[model samples]
Target: MNRWLARLLDTRVPALPLALFRIGFSVVMIIEIEQMYRFRRLLFDPMPYVIESTIPSGPLLLIWLAAVLFLLAGYRTRLAAVVHYVMAVIVLGFGALPHGEDWQGDSLILTLSLLLLFMPSDRVLSVERLMERRRRAREKVKDPGPVDVRLIHTVFLYLTIGLMYLDSAFFKLSSPMYLSGLGVWAPSTLPINAYHNVSWLMSQEWLVRPLGYALLAFESLFLFLYPVRRLRLPLLAVGALFHLGVMFVFPIPVISLLVLALYLGLVPAGAYERFTRLWRARAVSLTVYYDRLCPLCRQTVAVLDALDLRGAVAWKPLQDHAAEEPQLAAIPEEELLHDIYAVDRQGRIHKGVDTYAAVLRTSGWLAPLGWLLGVWPVHPVAQRIYGAVAEKRAREGGCRDGVCSLARPGAPAAEPAPHRGPGRLARPAAGVLLTAWLLSFVLIVPAGPLLRTYVTGDGALANRLENTAEYYKSRVYPWTGWTSHGVFMDEHFVNYRVQTMLVFEREGREPLRLPTIRPDGYTGSYNSGRLWELWTFETVKPELPLDQVERNMSRFVTYWAVRNGIPLEEGRILILQRPMDVTLDRFRRDRLADNLSQPWKEVGAITGSPGQLKVSFTGEPGNQSGLYGPRS
Candidate 1:
């Protein structure tokens, strides 16, 4: 029994699986973080976009990363493993029931990896245990051979994971929505839609159903096929392929990858050792420059340098070299030390914002953030802001010493009352007002689909008849609940456009008269062929049309139409069609074509059924002249 137990159990290989799991989990988390940053969105703004939880993902990421570092160091292994499990569970739980989505395949794997980490396998390869062993050896204590208990734990963990796969498969098969392709699962389908890759996937019928079924089978029957030791690796390889396929289709979270790593087992021990030997052999020196006098500056530099793994930066005391370096010497000794300073590999000197960028680029941690900072408007604006602060610091003189001296009368005080200027306040105030207006629009607008209008056929004949009331009845509004009347028409021959004005009041109430619009507020106005008035959506105050103003007006009308569910085709008809071409159907052509030779007396009832309207339309044109006819 002892020999059998020895053959079945081994402690030396435990870290391999854990390492794989750790690496995979880190990758997934990083990818998710990057994706969020790329979209410039928080968790709640986009679909499958959930409201960010109270526990911010950023802090949680730091916690998980700290656990990884602890595990790598092999320090307090048992405690680290336990903490790792707890953290993984909390993150995975949120992912599994992500506020907007269901258990994405990625979430399932993450949850499994957390479960696997709880196994006693750590007793074999833990750094804590190794340290303890070394301490015992130094004391000349006899070495214990192996821990069988840890082997047992590994076996149990593996079995538990295999069982989880089975459970996932079972649930997937049982899900009615999944079976019907209803896309209600949230994560899977929603991501597909977001990427705009749904059409391609859906078009491939052979791939879709089979891919779904394969995922189902892989999870459901994993253990049944690979329960024993020999088949485990191969089965897991297949499982890895399944996960890889999923990753290709959808950007999954890091936790899923980490869990998959566990299933794949760890790297060969020899390979790990070889890699570590090379890594250890390489020398990395990091130099960080911090002001020795300022406690705050010193602390920040210390934290940053500590986080730097590559040792690319070397910290130098700014005051020590202030007299030596030309750039440093150019700045007063105190001023140079007051602001942050860092140098890169190329012997280039950087200060303040530039230095921060250099350090971030060196760390390879802030590439995305740096890129955003480098973008126009952001870059220039940030540069100006940083410059102002630096100038202010220079004027104040040695804020680094934690003492302040007020600006002197002759020192050209840094933009006295900086906050009071139009340069600062005007832009921000305008931004605030614009933001408020947009927010109001978003909030007040109905969530329902926008109004749509469609126009077909050449518009030439419709425009010529002008003031006839029947001309306005044909436009479509998706949000229109009741009858609509078209009142205003502004014709432009140069642009070949006809502007139709439709005022929608409550269904029962008549629209207010044009005269009631108040002349004080209405400065720029034009007559509408004795029938109505034409007011450009923009500036009743402008009283003139500049190219830029017209362009802006065009944009406003387009955006309004789109948000209100007005179709592009309809908007174009209203904006670009000639006045004569704007009619639904010409009165003189359709009605009087065959009867042109005869006197144009009252028409006889010629019965051809007009189409039944899907949505209600009140066929009333403005009291003025216009024509609204067939949609085409």
Candidate 2:
């Protein structure tokens, strides 16, 4: 067993840090993604579409987090590496090229991701591979390749990342932006008007020249130095020095930390392991005192104990011997026996309300509970009630042998009952409430971020045409025995005519039921096949005498299609305008004759008042008019 453990660590040592870094960085990236969603940028902006179009990322973000937690739990090394690497790239791409507007955090994660992709950290203690080996050995399957894949991947990943810095340095040699004292290391906090600062440094030809040359030289040399194992540590050490200098001058916190971590990775794995062991050894647990008598109280205590965190909570009944501990010794035996109290890991005693939050924090399940505990008025109310109960218990005659004695001399007294309250089932209720919360988050929340696009006015009309064309292509055009409706144009609307147009023409007379028509037809004639139109009232011209009639026709045509170019007569052509004169028609024949004698032209021939007429004819003569709007 010792030999096996040694062999596993040896194989996994190189990849272990890389995995740890990847897991850490990925968690931050997931948080950023959530922030983007909160800001609406995830749904409305570019990053989400670039990746989520292929994978619905809202749910995928949760999956990625779960996978990383599994990795931290030491389960499924190879699978975790693969899953982590893929997500890291989706995250990486967004930080890399044109979209990489701010590259600090993402660049580091990308580098770590590439390293983990090729590492063999899973061979050591990964739960998935270990379980598989056990199950497979029983069937006699051969074990696969060298266990040092993780190391090899890490070496390559580091080399590539070092190359990025080298290229950046090299490019600065020629970039005016870098040379004008605007180089990454330039101080953003330089005193205003200081001649030695970046603003003036750009003008110092001799100084800038050597600085540029040095940057290129150091960067280019770094690429060659990083590959040699003996020199690798020195190279990383020098890189850390450079980053530290930049951190002092420039304001790039993310970049500086990333470089520091990379340098630290060069330290021997034994050192990191030792450090973690010491940290874990010094860790302490919190102690909670809960009642064990009431059924609800006992059950709650059991759950708290189950999540006891290795010793986070210690239960003591009203009669337990632990009540005699030094911390409780300060209070009189009667006072101590009256109410429950908890001593935190720091040895500070919390008697009532504050104890609940401490227990939750210690239990490591406060994420769902925090909001409830955090609510404004409710939190204070809960705390007050808890305090009241604790004080009331204290006021009762000191509980003795699970029974109460008198507090006031000669007062009628009853035995003190066990402490119970509305929140007694907080533990069990948490499980159910947490499940419900998670379900809502998993379904409705993700669905809410799904992308949708909407357009109004002419765009909607155009989209309708496009949809109609698609329907016609896929379903309607194939089996139908109907003729194609060729396109036509008219004064008030454009039309497509099939077997429906001829119904609109009644020789020399307006069609039946034509005068009562309204836009959309629902309030008027539902079955009537009439032309529909709509006008922009917002753009109306007041002097266009017939603006109201034109506006009405616009809406009418939106609901109806008016077709033209099909000849009404075999002989002549003409122009006609029939005014709906519910009020002005009272002038009678004198009005009719005056309207007829007036010359007519194509309606759109010349721009005039909306009611003015202009028409052009290429055929024999004719005249036409049709009724519109309600008749008196």
Candidate 3:
């Protein structure tokens, strides 16, 4: 077991996975911060009516922004990760007090960034790496790539994501609403959905049922299949498509995009490597060295062979007499294990992202894409993305005969996986850390509809290990009820079912209106068209007391009046709510064609009886109105 474990860690791969992930995650953190800043008045208002926060929003935001900048620059990165997570806890945990904000995306970012803290993310184009290069002492004892450290990071990453999604699937299976697909159908048909214009396509039962089942499968099955190499890319591709559909079809905010960004790490670097080699039908200007035994590469070779109309490139499998190839002889064998090497016409060597792009340029249609990838600014990111894919491909390629064992191109193939050194992560202390992580993983073990069917329940260890770890999150964690519960619910409330159109008027002048809620402050009035979140938070809340919705709206107008200098107590605020019977049927029949038709006719205030319904606010604060959580 000891030897087997060592070999597993010794498997050759690149540092690019963690390094590239660090870059993408930092960008996401920046965007979250920017969005919050853009809608400060709406999101961060400190009035008693707003959700109470544990810490000062200003300082927490400043600290978050500072940490994000350092993290993006890869300066003191581990420190940044620590700071980043600390802020997440403060904001998402405590700041989301009373009732939680949608915290799934924030939780994911926090967890992933926390994993980076344990890995060497500062090894790439980082300030720390550059500083190390300047020190003569550091140059003497160079560190071998920390493949073990990389594996540890990967373990933690999968462990976190797997637990979350698997539990989601479990909760989904437990929900009856999800079984019939009404959970998804309800939300997609709502006005809030950005793609409502085309969302009617899912009205087909065949499409909706399969889609519901697909989400359950994607979230649950991916956890098990993620570690398999041949199946890895395909799974990630499907996952990306799933998230893309979610992004447009629902109003789930930025979580889907964050998941898509993380999936960037799953794309193989050599995706274009050997495949483009066979496209050459003319004189060969470039020679590509690849493993002919690799199933993935062989398929690519066949496709390229079929596609090759002009012989412009040569794809050569690394034969026993690899050294006999003139230019290949000079290249080191160990590096070849991690990358597919390419030799140009003038004996110029190309590998990694550059090699794939160079060879791909031969195809007329793909030439533009290749050129774009090779450009200086774009190539850096492209290189890392390719490295992420290639490293995984090479790791899973497996040793063929003894040929893959050779450390140099000319040397005889004699080994399996290469073990270069006693890397830092292989130390006893590192072993202890890994052991602790694995032990804790048990508490969050997998068991859901997918797992229970085959692995547990009536299967092997049914009683010994719980089939699912739902109790801890679904019940134990208070906030998680809000944060995580909606995975497979058969029905999501259509927020637009009761839309409120607020038209405010001063004593003498016309009720002022603008395109939408201006970020600056309240104009005279706004329609219910684009104020989905704001209006829904305040008025569409049915669970609240009839007076509770009024209090919430009044607080908003009070704040708005403060910002825009309006005497709110003397003004009239007209409220109109769209009923479900009228709106839902109209939506099904018209499919957004009659979107401009107001639901006010069905539920709006009586047009002629202005004085019948007169409600007044004293501008005095009482109990804060609860919007996100009416039950609380």
What C-alpha lDDT values do all the predictions have? Answer: 0.39, 0.40, 0.54
- Angstrom error at residue 518, model 3: 11
Score every model by TM-score.
0.34, 0.34, 0.59
lDDT per residue for candidate 2 within 1-632, as digits (tens), equals 33432332234344445544544444544554454334222222232222223444456566666666666544765577578666655544442121222233454555555455445445443554455444333223333422333233344445444545543553444344344443332222111101122333334545644654555566758767765767765666667776665544333334555556555545445555676564341444556554443333344454455444334456666446555567766766544444556776667876555566666766555535635664678679887876565444322334453444323223323434433232344334434433442332232211111111122334555455445544443331112111111111011111110001001233666533222222211112211111111111111111222434343332222122211222323221222222211111011222222322343333221112212222222232221111122221
- Cα TM-score of candidate 1: 0.34
lDDT of 1 by residue, 1-632 (tens): 43433433433343555544444544554454343333211232211122234555655656666665676555665566566556655554434213212223333434444443544444444555565454433333344544333243344345445544543443344343334432211222321112123334444445555665565566657767764556666677777776565444333323245446566443334455566465341443323466654433444554455445455666677668655545455566555655676555455677776666666666555556657776787778878887665444322234555444344223221322312122334344434433543343332221111111122123443333221212221111111111111111111111211222222223345532122122221111121110111132221112223332233223333333333444333212111111212221111222111211222111111111111101222233321112222222
Error of 2 at 517 (Å): 59
Per-candidate clashes come to 38, 23, 17
The best candidate in terms of TM-score:
3
Per-residue lDDT of candidate 3, residues 384-458 (tens digit): 887666544522234532223222223222334544555775656446655654544454444334345445556
Comparing 1 with 2 on TM-score, the higher-scoring candidate is 1
lDDT of 3 at 33: 77
lDDT of 3: 0.54
Provide C-alpha RMSD values for all models, in order.
25.2, 26.1, 13.8
> Which RMSD does model 1 reach against the true structure?
25.2
